[model samples]
Target: MTAATSVVAGETLPSSMRASVLTGALKISMDERAVPTPALHQVLVHVSKVGVCGSDIHYYREGRVGPFVVDAPLVLGHELSGRIVAVGEGVDTSRIGERVAVEPQKPCRLCSQCKAGRYNLCPFMEFYATPPIDGAFCEYVVIESDFAHAVPDAVSDEAAALIEPLSVGIAASRKARIVPGSRVLIAGAGPIGVIATQAARAFGAAEVIVSDPVAERRAMAMRFGATSTIDPMTEDSRPLKVDAFVDACGIPRAIVSGLESLRGAGVAVLVGTGFDEVSMPIPTIMNNELVVTSVFRYTDTWPLGAHLVASGQVDLDSLVTSRFDLDTVEDALNADKNPDNLKTIVEAK
Candidate 1:
């Protein structure tokens, strides 16, 4: 084997590999590209599974999400699980072959948010799959070693990929300060909402209610531990009984409806990303003295999420409604637009 082809026990090998490139809006092409070598604190990972996220589908269709516009070709995917194929110089080789769920956000540790242990809000974060930061929808990805958390053998690769989204739910639960016997209402029974339902239950919420326009998703939410499912299109003024609410739809309508369901002095946590400038019922929020907060990504929750899935406390497998190979990534993303499907995954083979 050539020196370039050979990899040291821990050090990253030579550059270049294959990846799915987003050449333009609604266009994806498979292309061979240079693999990245890991830096001093990084490791090269052989990606095994990537969860098809809503953001990925949005980027595939529009080539941009919010302010992050894609002017050049970029690979897209964030929820990922992989094995450590190689590590960087001065790094420990003991991690080689270890399975892990990668934390896609790389925050600057010196930032105020980082110091405050709220790294998810770090302004200088370079999150994977976001515009300008090519993500792990490829055969290999090199990331900081600390950002990858080791997964137990009990966690399947599918479940490992879900750790990313699960972490988001966990973070949201923490922000809401969920407690036993608290009535929690979750809007949008998508992956995040479904997972949040399960997380809220685990956190001791007495009753967990979910709302979604999609019949399939609302039904799936019940299977995943939601105490009840509310279809906003059909159910009116019914959600107003919950003590707390979580807005996962990113739609203005859902936000308004979820707030309407909250009791006085209740909390509402917004956990979804949509187009900018979503209007809310500010007067109602003021009248109820509701505490409104938003969570961006996650912070220090990967290990907890891993534990939840590995221990079988949260059934991550049920959330995966479909899977596709790398070659069929486009089709998989397209299928995600269908309301019938809950979560889609892409397997690297």
Candidate 2:
């Protein structure tokens, strides 16, 4: 219930809306904020659901992720689904009332990276939930109209929100060049690992092996698409002779082992966040002529991600294990602490 005025999408616009804000480490509070208006080429969306990401939990537990600090009352949520209620100048009015998955990133179009179709590397990117940028843990959010990717009726709101993470998996798969009959090694059975496994399969990998210390996560990986699972504690990975290695777990030991597991000329895609600097086995990488890369954020991925979910190539809804509303966002942020929980979502309504 908020003050209503302009009507769009068969619903009145609100003068103000509720937002879950993070004031400091482990501190969240509900705050009333004025609804924002869309700028040129932007769209105002009535937020429906927001997926709680590992990075969100990182910001919740710590005041910052690396250099991005929470210095003010910052709204925290990036993976989200919503309905477009209003369009800014230069946007088509027909977009209103369309269900969409927000890409949550606005990179400067003038940068060299953006010009080269690698906007994820744009230094001027304004990604949601990052410091100085308010995210979508609110009733309404304004994003570039192009970033508000419409979804098919077959895609649920929860699945739409999950497109964000699935895009990361796609980015990782592309980086590793997972191809037909490719044997892939994925370290970690976390959400990223599970999604990466599916992405690898979709990209035509014949053998997908996931390594995790947790038994349940390993099972979860198998359920999704992993051809096999490895208990990093007891099992060895080098024998797999994988063509590519994707490290979704940032653990140093796992990374070292994953690198060693790769066959000669294999590619290693590092998708997990870890210490700023870590020593690597340079000799092995040099001798094998292996290529190593990292994913910063995804670019030009939402459309394909939505298509994969709609076509049943990827399963996003099954990842959800918990749901909460704006008021209980604190509990949502803490959901990762539970071993049984795979993914948590927050309803803006």
Candidate 3:
């Protein structure tokens, strides 16, 4: 039977919904799809807002990001927030009608990584918008109840959707071991870099220096808690000393420069997705005792992300440069082409 023919009990909801499907590179078709029914321990969410991410754009422009390729039709959107409309068995009915921010990852809870609270490293993980797994560029989607984190009234729908990226920033900050009175140097002023600045400050970093090529983004970073800004295009030769370096820009030169800028025993946390491999100064790393690490996806960061947004410690609305609807998801994914644009949101509801 079709999904429309088999409806979940309780809610009088439509069986079919509109979805923006990525048929191939640079091609998106608006297709009607069945509104999915929540399975056991899952919740049916009426997707409201989805934030456009760089990975989504990669999948759109190249049909691939690293090894994950889009050979079949796909739906591309992961940073999303919505309202719970229905609940499956094992979920409390009271959860219905709650506003929530989705974590967008389903990891095998039985894995060793999951047992250690590092589910982001679960070997058999399914992430939204990553080729095979369909994402939230549709009217309704179902996610595990635990991954659907409820947001406070103070967090707007757009902010709730953006909590996903904020979690990324939080994860990077945690990995960098940022502490009160620490100094942090963040390369790149993109959405993640800007958010990382806020996360660092919230984590008690005394100073956050942001380096970027764009003047507008550098200025924007200042408003988002950056103590100072640098134009890497002109100031790439300058040296800096800091407790931690967060590379939000995938550029190789920036990574090398950031490594050079670190003080002895400093930590470097790489958050950006660059090429598969890049050369690094091994001798410098050893001599300085600089700890280097990278983040795949966030692990157990949704609650802190939401709390930061609700408490006004982080301002997400300021980063929203444009808005689009599900029908215009193509435009939303390409919004970043405009250098002035910081972040774009696609409304599915």
Candidate 4:
């Protein structure tokens, strides 16, 4: 079922909504908030599904991530999908019924980075769920019309929200240069890891090996696209001579292990968020002529993510292991403690 309410043309929207707010570390409260009206060139979306990400957990657990700290109350949720319920001036009113996957970050188009087509690096980017930037953990949210990407009917609400993570996987695949007949190794069989496996296969990788400590996650990786799964705990990762290695786990050791497994002239893409300080294998990297790169949030990836799900090249529904309503958002955030769950979805309406 869809995650939000359906509205018709010219229908008057409600005045208020129930908002899930983060007051501090491990503190969450449901409060009444006014429904936001879309501004010019914007559309009001009836929020449906919100995917709980690791960053959300970090904020919930520590009240901060890197330099961004929670000094005031905020909403937390970036991965989202919803249906357009209203439109602002200059927007086509007929788009009110379109189901869309919201691209949470909006960059300043006038910046040099945006002009050069590297909008993800725009210094003035307003990203949702980040400190001082409220996200969509409420029933209604407004976004620029261009950021509300339409999705085909075949994609479920939860799957649509997951496109955010899929976009991350796609970005990593592009950076790592996963091509036909290429052998790729992915570290960390978490949500991003599994999605990266599928993205690699779609990029025509001949073989994908997924490494993880959990037996369940490794099995999940195999189901997604991994030709083989290895338990990093008991197995040595240096034996695999793959052309590309993607670190989705973010652990420093995992990154080092992936580096050790790469072939000469191979590439390594860091996708996971780890410690600010990491020790690189400088000698091995220089000797092998290895290329190491990293990807931030995606750019020009929503349509690709939609197409991948629509065309059946990637399966998104299989990633879900738990679901919660907005009232139970805290439980969804803590779901990672349960090793069996891969993805947790929170319904905003």
Ranking 3 against 4 by lDDT, winner: 4
- Model 2: lDDT equals 0.91
Best TM-score goes to which candidate?
A: 2
Report the CA-based lDDT of candidate 4 relative to the real structure. 0.92
Per-residue lDDT for 1-349 in model 2, tens only?
A: 1222344646678789999999988999999999998888998889999999888888999888888888888999999999988888888787888999999999999988899999988899999999899998999999998999999999999999999999999999999999999999999999999999999999999999999999999999999999999998999887777899999988888888988999999999999987777689999899999898888888889989999999999999999999999999999999888999998999997
Task: Compose the digit string of candidate 4's lDDT tens values, residues 90-193.
Answer: 88877889999999987899999999999999999989989899998889888999999999999999999999999999999999998999999999999999
Candidates sorted by TM-score, best first: 2, 4, 3, 1
- TM-score, each model? 0.94, 0.97, 0.96, 0.96
**What's the true lDDT of residue 221 in model 3?**
95
Candidate-wise lDDT, in order: 0.85, 0.91, 0.91, 0.92
User: Candidate 1 residues 49-76, lDDT tens each?
Assistant: 9998888888888877878888889899
Model 4 ranges with Cα > 4 A deviation: 1-6
Segments of candidate 2 deviating more than 4 angstroms: 1-9
In candidate 1, position 23 carries an lDDT of 86
Candidate 3 residue-wise lDDT at 293:
98
Counting only residues 3 or more apart in sequence or on different chains, how many pairs clash (N, Cα, C under 3 Å) in candidate 3?
0
